[model samples]
Target: MASEPGFLPRDGLDRLIEALRRDGREVIGPRVRDGAIVYAPIAAAADLPAGVRDAQSPGAYALHAVSPDERLFAWANGPQALKPLVFVPHELLWSSRNDGADGPQFTAAEPAARPTAVIGVRACDLAALALQDRHFLREPYPDPAYRARRDALFLVAVHCTHQADTCFCASTGDGPEAESGFDLALHEIDDGFIVAAGSDAGAAVLAGLDLAAADQARMDEARAGVEAAAAAQSRSLPSRDLRPTLLERLESPQWDAVAERCLSCGNCTAVCPTCFCNAEVNEATIDGRENGHYRQWDSCFTSGHSYLHGIVIRSETRARYRQWLTHKLAHWHDQYGRSGCVGCGRCISWCPVGIDLTAEVAALAGEGTA
Candidate 1:
């Protein structure tokens, strides 16, 4: 986390975790759990998923151990990202109680969130976080709860040294190497990590580690790994803006083909970091004196999402799939000035049926329609 890049030896990483905990930040990082790299509370460098390489493809993900190595942060990404840290999956909005005889009193529920530092944040997630910020922190009515959690978050990115077959962040201009939005960033090499600070807080943390300046050879080693990761990626979305391509092909038969295979289980939206749809619920007490109002994550594929006045506008999976793709690649540009997809490929890997969007896009555009 230094202004000039520094070498953080493997053991030094342990101290870095300590430094964050000392700063009263909850240290969250990648951990090997439940057969996937998931974000959990990490106390030391050993908590990282070491020597574990992940294989990712359409509808498949597996983590294999290649031990006798000291490398940590060797995997691309897991099913988790920075989304849940700030934009909570479930949250309480407010509650109303009739303690008085005259009128019921309403109280706004403030979220209790501690200062948190997350490690191993990838470029795609960072890009997704920016889009989330634009949506949640927009003018006129900013989300108070999301803003509070976001402000207390500290990001530590890891430059990708490995690319999954499903990854296309390189072509999306979001990854393989992070361009911005992290407090600190790291490039993993044989000896250790080459660390750099992108913010004052990151610099302060680096100052406590007593790291040495990264030499040219070590720096180049880390840089080369990242470059190679980019070169190895095979999947990429269409180069042009997908908005025009998709909007013009509203009647494309590809939608029906994809829908036939799609389960409409909402796995894609659930894993997508940029999806922000939520459903509100009000539960009234038995006596009717109090009511609990809550909001939780929802997906566009859900029938309730399109249900209005006893009608489901997008009742069919074909319509729902088209809506999701169009909004993610087209309408999002109108709202956030960019595409919603960060090209992390979570949708592809997590989809139970292996519906690759890249191939679907090409089909709809008539580039390679079968």
Candidate 2:
């Protein structure tokens, strides 16, 4: 890492990975997995998906290997989001044990976390992280487990020069370019990468690196590439106050129309980076002497998610589907002062029934126009 924005040759990436490891940080990054890019433990820069790209559409996703000379950051968003890394899908909250004397005693479970440096983070994921910070850190009762994982993370954000057909980050005002919330940011160019530090730790790493200073001409080329990516996005939300509009139409027939096509499989919320719903369960042995309490990710689409007093609220698929869409686009604003959807297109790409929220909202507004 240089003291300032600088040029790093392709091989510098391997050195960076080594530098993080030398600092006792576990490095996690995008790698080819089960025909898709998934974040996993990475040992070296070779673990990155160089010259790989993904084809994504509603109900479909496929990865392809491009030219060997292709840039490392050529792929767009993957099915997995940043939520799983920090929020965690499931965790033991506490365990109850009894000695031979008194009743059961409960011991709180702590988060098992390691200092981690995450590479290949995209702009939309950064936005999602910020929103999650507000919810998990700023809430009335902050989640200690989430806080632990979040505090242990070092983000390495990368600019997206490629756009997927399902992406609409431009409309969400989130991406194609990552502007903040990163320790170090990298912009990939033909010759190499333009790297800049956004924090003191990042600056310290850069100061020890053997890299050349980036010139204005190189910066200009990188800006052009990002702009081209933004323009290439074919999908976008309508330029209007979507929150108020969607709220007003809570009773719209469009909800039923969309529910007809929805599978209620919870794939949208599962892939969503900002969906924070969860449920807690208490499991006990057949003897009923000890109990294990655990928390797991839950989806609003489940029939039992809203169960209360021997009856289920939002019993119909239409109501559950409405809860998901309205909460994502409308109610999230009231709760977080921002939209939950980062426009990364994971929801669209992973949906089994190909239900696009952008299209559903368009239908509510009348001619189904973009």
Candidate 3:
């Protein structure tokens, strides 16, 4: 791909935000909230986290201050993602009522309002969302709800200068730098930012912004910085041929050992960006005259998730746990041409049991069983 011109400085960002606001679009980005960087609506430049960083660990998170005074883009990934802002956790599909003599009347529920731009999206999250795009929006049977949310929103992906111990985007070939699927990509370079357009919508936003043309030297320097940060990743998985190994070791003994510590809480799948399994439930009136059906997020770890004619496929916690991990790292490639995991490590961070997928995979592979 040819290199595109970059943004000038902080002034260009202001102009872009103003443009979005003028269009009556809600401009959401990273903002400091109770010491953590979170995605929320921004009214001005001052709302962004100027110079602060977050401390992340498995089941622990905290925020701290950074030195640079004018640097507005000096924060890491937040606990919250752009998923809920787009795909609502719960929604009323439809409802009906009875008028006695007139019989039953149905009312169609309106879809979620289209959101505008989502700024400061980390590269890993963007890659995970790309995987979801293939599953929900680009598949043979497309989800209208997901399609509407995906098509209407704008994306602003940010390069991660620092990686947490839990992060393994490098292992998955997903992150540390924004590659594509972004409307605009921002890399923090000193006191300013190096912005690149990734789509036509991004170009349009850039055209209206007050950014100066990025020279060859500046662009090259910015690209080099991004590459260096990505190269400096401290954690990674040896997953080049993981799928075949995992497939061969489906009945491996390593699974039983790991399952001993697993609570089967489904926290891993809930926090995972690409795990999109859902289940439908019908709500009916006491008289059974009116009812509404709805679908909600589901997890393979849950016993009901694998329910087949009232009998669960994997009744044991060990089997259910093994099924999820193996499918994510192994079989997902056969189905989607890519591993289901983006190596974001949210699963590691949020799991109450502190079960590490990387450690499990490494142990299995080392035993010559995976």
Candidate No. with top lDDT: 1
Q: After superposition, how far is residue 22 of candidate 1 from its true place, in Å?
A: 1.2
lDDT of each: 0.89, 0.87, 0.77
Residue range 277-300, candidate 3, lDDT tens digits: 788787998997887867788889
Evaluated against the true structure, the overall lDDT of model 1 is 0.89
**What RMSD value applies to candidate 1?**
1.5
Residue 155 CA displacement from its true place in model 3, Å:
0.6
My TM-score estimates for the predictions, one after another, are: 0.97, 0.96, 0.89
Candidate 2 Cα outliers beyond 4 Å, as residue runs: 1-3, 285-289, 367-370
Candidate 1 local lDDT, 49-85, one digit each (tens): 8889999989999999999465788788888888998
lDDT score, candidate 2: 0.87
What lDDT is obtained when candidate 3 is compared to the true structure?
0.77
Best by TM-score: 1
How much is 54 displaced in model 3, in angstroms? 2.0
Q: Looking at candidate 2, what is the lDDT of residue 270?
A: 89
